[model samples]
Target: MKKAIKILFVEDEEALGMVVSDSLRSRGFEIDYHTDGESALQATLTNKYDILVLDVMLPKMDGFSLAREYRKVNRNTPIIFLTARSQTEDVVEGFELGGNDYLKKPFSMEELIVRVKSLIGRLLYSEESQLEECFVGNYKFNIQKQTLELNGKIKTLTYREAQVLLMLFEKRNQVLERKLVLDQLWGDDSFFNARSMDVFITRLRKYLRDDSNIQIVNIRGIGYKLLI
Candidate 1:
C-alpha cells in the first residue's frame, strides 16, 4: 500500500480544526493538528511532514510568520493557507508570502482534498523528471544532481534553488506564476515564502551573471519569465 501523506495542520479555531482533521483522517491522510502558531511552528521544526495547512490568523505568530520561519529550516514541504480573509489583496499577500494554495472559509472539504492530492502529485512527480538535463540559456542544469554547468564549470544549487531553477528552465520564456513556483518549491505561496524566493532569485541572478543574454524577469503580479 502507498504511504499516507503526512500533514501539519495549524489552525486556531478548535471546532474547524477538529472537523478538518477528522475529515482528512477519514480520507487516509496522517495529520498532526495544532491550535496555535507557536506549537505548530515547533512541530514543523522538529518533525517531518509532507504538507502544511495553515491559518492566517493565530496566537503568538500569524500563519504567514510561521510559514516564513519554517522556510528558514525546511524548503520543500508544501504549504496551503486556509484563511477567512478573502479580499484580493489578502489573497495576493498570501501568494506573496509563499503559499501554494489558498482556501477561504466555508470551503468544501472535497475541494480541499482534491487540491492537496494534486499539489502533492505535482511536487513528487513532475513532468520534468522525464529529462535528465535541461538547458537554460547557456547553462546546462542536471536535475538529479541539482547542478548547473557552463563552459565546463559546475555550480551546485541548494535544494530549493535547484527546484526553482528547474521549473523555470522547463518553462523557459513562459510566464511561470509566482504561486505555482512557490507551491512547487516550498509548498505554499505566502508573503514570507515569496520574500524567501526573492532571496533565492537574487542568488540565482548572481550565479548566472556570466551569461548576459539570459535573464529571469519578474512579471509584476503574474510571476517570472526565464528569458533565454
Candidate 2:
C-alpha cells in the first residue's frame, strides 16, 4: 500500500478548518488539525510531518511567529500559509519566515491540494542522491553544510547567502534572471527585494574576490551571469 502523506494544518476558523481538513483526509492525507499556534508549535517540535499548512491568524500566537520559531530547528519540511492578507509585503514576509507557498483566503480546495502535492513532490525529488559539494573557482562549496572553503580557510554562509550562491552555482556559466532569484528567495521582485539582492550580490563578490578567475557579471537591464 502507498504511504499516506501527513500534514500539520493550523487554522482558527472552525468551519473552514473542518472543511479543509476533512477534504484533505478524504484524499488520503493524514491530517493533524489545530486551532491555535501554540499547540501547533508544540506539535512541530514533537512530530515530523511532510508539510505544514498554517493560517496567518490564530489564537495565542500568529502564524508568522510560529513558522519563524519552527524554522530555527527544522528547515527541511515545507510550509504553506493560508492567509487573507494578499498584500505583497505580507506575502514576502511569509516567505522570509520560511514559508514555501502562500495561499490567500477563499482559495479552492483543489488549488490547496495542488500546492500541497507540488511541494511534496519537489521535496521528495530533491532528496535524491546528488553531489553535496562542488568546486566554485577554487573554492569548495558545500550545499548542505552552507560552507565555502578556500586554501584551508572556511567561511560559513548565512542561509540566504547560501541559497543565492547555490542557485548561481547550479546555473554556472549561464544567465540567471534577476526576477527569478527574487521570486525564489524573496517571493517577489519588488524594488526593496531588488535592492536586497544587489546587496547580497555585492557581498558574494567580496567573498569570491580571491578567485581572480571567478566573476559574477551583471548583464545590464537584464540579469546576472556567473562567468567562471
TM-scores for candidates 1 onward, in order: 0.67, 0.78
Q: Give all candidate RMSDs, comma-separated.
A: 5.8, 3.8
Clashing pairs in 2: none
The runs of at least 3 residues in candidate 2 whose Cα sits more than 4 Å from the true structure, single-residue gaps closed, are 137-139, 147-164, 177-223
Q: Model 2, residue 181: what's the lDDT?
A: 89
Per-candidate total of colliding backbone pairs = 16, 0
List, residue by residue over 1-228, the lDDT tens digit for candidate 2.
998999999999999999999999999999999999999999987898999999999999999999989988877688898888756677657755667777778999888898888778866765663967899999999877768999999987655677788889888999999999887665568775677678778888988999999999998977888878
Point to the candidate with the largest lDDT.
2
Error of 2 at 1 (Å): 1.1
Runs of candidate 1 with Cα error greater than 4 angstroms are: 126-135, 138-168, 171-212, 215-226
Please, what is the whole-model Cα lDDT of each candidate in the order they appear?
A: 0.81, 0.84
- Residue-level lDDT of model 1, residues 1-228, one tens digit each, is 999999999988899899999999999999999999999888876789988999999999999899888866765566788988856666655644556677878889998897788778866785446777877778988876668999999997655677788878878899989999877655577775577678778878988989999999999999999899
User: Which candidate's TM-score is highest?
Assistant: 2
